[model samples]
Target: MITRSERTLNYAVLVLFSVIALFPVLLILSTALSPDEIGAGGSALSLEFGNFAEAWEQGNFGSYMRTSVIVAVSVVTLATLFSVMAGYAFGTMQFRGSEVIFYLILLGIMVPAEALVVALYFDLRSVGLTNTLVAIVMPQVAQSVAFGTFWMRAYFRSSSREVVEAARLDGAGHWRTLWRVLVPMGRPAITTMIVLMFMWTWNEFLIPLVMATDESLRTAPLGLAFFQGQYTAGTSLLAAGAVLVALPVVVVYLFLQRHFIRGMVEGVAK
Candidate 1:
């Protein structure tokens, strides 16, 4: 069914796109491994391992890595739990105010994090939670839960409603039905949400920076900002730090790629 010319053109386009998309990643990897002492003389092609060595040491990445990991894990866990709970309620439980609550939650997407950050900072200051890991993680979790609840709710609505009814017929309560039935069936969508929330939280900068001034509480993005601010110019070390921050998320996505694609496709199908 494929013509030779068309096939050739497709291949050419794919190759072009692959290069365009991957060039930055390749550049990051190269810079991450380049010699720190090379100091702009070293080409990306001739990168050594010294750049990462210096970056890790100078950036205090070990501590940043720990803080980032803690924040990301906490945000993802809390957000997913809250989202799933609310999604189940909206999708199954009947209530007069369901539509209103759902729409209000959906409105969260319209509100930019930056717009509310000023008020959020002062509110946290009043509670004396500023400059703490909780300050960063709490806001990110709330933000994640907002959209996450909507995503899962749509899936729950369009997904196997019959199964839920069957569970109820079998005397399963709401919690039991969600855990035993919807959870397993919703794995594809849930996995996709997890990947999304994790990526967003991992890369989120503004809230973490504004909420937590302590270096010890900074997330990867916040630390990256500080690092960039300290460096304040074109340098491979900052690029290497970015590489370090990006690798984990990239690795996880590669592993869950199937679920990610499936979630989107199934979501659209529904």
Candidate 2:
């Protein structure tokens, strides 16, 4: 019962917003492609593919990227596994003080890292974990678990009880029921959670900055900040570095976008 004019208007509005959101990305890409002398405002007619190489080498992004990958992968894997177990428990099963324990974990989501980073630094330092991969990965895992538990819990809560009951009737244990059944069925939701956790873990700055003083321990975003300060006059290099730091997350999202969108829509619908 929609009119053609209304549909057209909606399309026009969507196009406008899309362009607005994409503008900064386009600008950064253009600037990254521009020559050093011409800077950000310069034309991309002269595409400088070498800017990325120069940025990569000069910024030591090879090391930063490796660190980011290690941290992100570790955090995502741990957080997702823990989140699934916790979410499945909270969403499908009941136990003593379950609500209370779940609410306590939820506090992590509400608390800002800025408020805890200083204290967290002392805690890690006391344990002699500062400047170590464990320091970087563990805190992020905890942070991610908070939100991941919440996300997966929603999906599990609204999951098909009939399927679960059937699994039980088939003599499938909780472990079998989860891995053999619900996990496969909940792919979209789990994938969405992975993408989100990867993004957040990859981009985290404050905790990495405070906990690690080792140059090799710097995450991509922290490296970018230092790279920016060092390359204040090198706009092309800065833009290229920005793109490099962001490319992994972009690639991840692009690959998982279908599942990501489906999960979001389903979550909302449910």
In Å, residue 220's CA in model 1 sits off its true spot by 1.1
Tens-place lDDT digits, model 1, residues 1-270: 889999999999999999999998888776566566547656655566556666778787767778999999999999999999999888777999999988888888657789878998999899898898788888889888887888889878887878888999999998999999998998878888888788778888888879877778877777777898988544778888887788788888799877656554543411
Cα error of candidate 1 at position 142, Å: 1.5
lDDT score at residue 245, model 1, on the 0-100 scale: 82
TM-score of model 2 vs. true structure = 0.86
Per-candidate TM vs. native? Answer: 0.87, 0.86
- Model 2: per-residue lDDT, tens digit, 1-270? 999999999999999999999999999998888788644544454357878887778768888898999999899999999999999999999899999998888777877788878888898889898999998998889988988888888889999999999999999999999999999999878888888788778889998989879989999999999888876644878899899999998887788877656555543411
lDDT (CA) per prediction: 0.81, 0.86
Clashing pairs in 2: none
